[model samples]
Target: MALDRPTPVTFHAPMVLAVGLPPATLSRAGVVLEPSGVALRESNLLDLRSDSAKYRPLVLLVDAELYDFDPEAFDMVAQDVGAKLGVAGSAREAEVTLGQLMAALARKSAFPPPPSSADAKTDKWDFSEVVAAVAAQGGRE
Candidate 1:
């Protein structure tokens, strides 16, 4: 008589793409699974814009202390790869951040983004308009 077992599925994504992180951060994140038994890959910002990404549902982690720490650039990277941003300020923080991102990507999770301010019909001057009206009414009663 024999028993059978299952194997880890080959996820569409390569799991993790770590950028500019300290060497010790990955393991400290304490992510427990290797869904594809595949380890992470190191990357540069330029690679993110390419059409050929290594995986799907990938987690992109970047260090805040990069030589040219530009928030806009990193945001663009995340957009190009259709990924959420995880910026770590230090070695310790990177570990915690890595763990958080890894947890979010696990178990085939699908989290839709929350509504954006663009959904509102209000204009950019709306707040100032309200302020003017309040001032016209003779300050707080």
Candidate 2:
């Protein structure tokens, strides 16, 4: 769906290690999944497990905004399609995304939808904040 948001969101925190490849960065905004894994960009699901192949797993680290719309059901459909494409992985943390699919979401709109009253106390950081922090720590996005 549309990637507009009030703040930023950190989509994933995967620490993938591979020889000769730069670190991969990933995050999610709305239904858009952006992986800064440019080195492994050429490798798709079918060739994922090969030693010489470069690819990252599709992992979900958050389940909020998209879940307000029943993300599990949406993930089921995604899983089915991924399976057909030889992509294997469990849907953890609950898979969800906006109905309108986009390639990527803007950084400012990365913040997840507002939290519920009970969950509002949880601490959250915007995507740019995290990215800047990571960059300060020698991590590229």
lDDT of 1 at 16: 60
**TM-score per candidate, in order?**
0.51, 0.20
Candidate achieving the largest TM-score: 1
**Model 1, runs deviating above 4 Å:** 1-11, 26-38, 105-141
Query: Residue 36 in candidate 2 has what lDDT?
Result: 40
Top-lDDT candidate index: 1
| Per-residue C-alpha lDDT of model 2 across residues 1-141, encoded as one tens digit per residue | 898878875443322211111122122221123344322123222333452222232332222343344555435533543321111121221122211222233443587877788986767999999988888888543
Model 1: lDDT of residue 68: 53
Write down the worst ten-residue block by lDDT for model 2: 17-26
Error of 1 at 94 (Å): 2.2
Question: What lDDT score is found at residue 116 in candidate 1?
Answer: 90
**Residue 6 CA displacement from its true place in model 1, Å:** 26
lDDT of 2 at 114: 75
